[model samples]
Target: MSGHRTRKWVRVAGTAQICALLIGMAAGGCARLPYTTQVIHEDRRVVVTLQRETRPVPYSHPVQLRTDELAAALAGFSFREKQRLPLRWFAEEVPPKQIFRSDELQAVVPYLVEGLQKAAPDERVYFQVLAPGMNPAYEKDTTAGWIALREPYLHLTLEHFHAQFPVRKSEQWDLRYPALPPEPKTYLLYFEPGRFWETDPVTGQSAVQLREFLKIAIPASSR
Candidate 1:
C-alpha cells in the first residue's frame, strides 16, 4: 500500500523531456488545452494545516500574551509581501497590511485573553480588535468577532463588517485600485465565516479563506 501510494505521488511535477515523451506516447498526439494563469484567492482570517499523524492542539488553558507578544503573533495572520516574495503581486485586492494596530490591540487583547482563560469548553472569547486610522484621531478600524479555545482546526471568523476605509486599508493605500470608502458603511462579507467553516468541500476540510486584512506564529515579534 505504501509503495502504491508513493507510486501514485509524483515527487516533482514534470520535465520538458518527460512531457514530450508522454505526449508522443499519447494516443491522439499533443493538443493545446487552454489554461488560466489567474490565481483564485481564498480570503480568510485563519488557515489551518492538518497532518495525518499529528494530534490537534486546542486552546484549553489560560493563555496570556503581552501586548508585544500578541502583536507579534498577529503578524502571521496578516499578509506579508516579503513572505510571498516573487508572488507578491498575485491576486491581491489591497496592499498587504496588518489590520489591527499595536496600541489599539493593547486596549482589548488583555481582556480577551482573560476571557479565554476563563472560558469553559465550547465557550468562545469575543473580541473587537481595532487599529488607529493613519490620521490616528480620525481613523479607527475594527475587526469584531469571537475566537474559540485552541482546537485542531482554525475558528477565527469575521461576522459583520460595516466600515468605510478601514484604518489598515488607508495605511496600506499607496494609490491602490480599490477607491477608499467615502464614509463608514456596513458591508456584508461575500462569504460568511461560520457557514464557510462548516460547508464548502475544499475550504471546509483543509483550506481556509483569509480575511481581516489577517494566527499562531512567532511574527511581528518586533512590535
Candidate 2:
C-alpha cells in the first residue's frame, strides 16, 4: 500500500469499526502462519523485526515478551523518525484477520516502556497506536476509555503510551512503514520530549510546532 493509501485507510479506521470485523473474518480461517521477532539495539536507533518464519508454522507456540524483556529489547534507541513501519510482514505471512491479534506481540508494550525508561531515563518516548485505519484524533480520556472498553488491537499501543508518556497533548502523522515498500505501510507513534506552543505569536494562529520534527516519506519502490 502506498503511504497515501495507508493514511487514507487510517483515516477510515479512525471512524469505522470495520477493522474489527476484518480481524474476526481473518481469524476464522485456517492455516496458521509462522512469525519471528528480532530486536536490534544500536546507539541512536532500535530496529524491531517482526517477520515471517521461513520454516513452517511450528507446533510450539511463540513465547510472549515480558514487560522488562520488551523494554530491554527497545532500550537505547530513539524513534526520532516517527514512522510506523508497515505491517507488511503480517500481510505476507498471516491472514488479515489474524494481523493484529498476536498476544505475543501485543504483550510487548508495557515492558517496552519499562526498558525505554531504563535506556533513556531522562528522555521522553512515544509509540504509535493508530494503524492504517484509525481516527485521526481522539479525546485523550475518551480514547483511553474506549480502548479500555473496546480492547482493540490498538489498545496495545495506547495503553503503553498512557503508562509511559502520560502527557495528553500530541500530534500524529502517517509515515511509510519501514522496510516494506511500494505496497504496504504502517502508523508511526511519537513521544514528545518537551512542551511547545501550537500557536505562532507572529501569526496569532495555531499551528503544531512539533510537526517539523516528523518524518514523512515513501520508499522509492512505492513512489
TM-score for each of the candidates: 0.35, 0.18
Cα lDDT, all candidates:
0.39, 0.30
Best by lDDT: 1
Model 1 spans with C-alpha error above 4 angstroms: 1-67, 79-93, 129-141, 151-155, 160-223
The lDDT, on a scale of 0 to 1, for candidate 2 is 0.30
Q: What is the Cα root-mean-square deviation between model 1 and the actual structure? A: 21.1
Model 1, range 1-223, lDDT digits (tens) per residue? 5965654443223234456567777967666532222211112221111111122334443444354444433433333223253454562555444445555455655565455555544345555444454556545444554454343333444432323233334222233322344432332222223332333242243212222212323234532
Give me the candidate number with maximum TM-score. 1
What TM-score does candidate 1 get on C-alpha atoms? Answer: 0.35
Give the range of the ten consecutive residues with the poorest summed lDDT in model 2: 144-153
Q: What is the C-alpha RMSD of each candidate to the true structure, in Å?
A: 21.1, 22.3
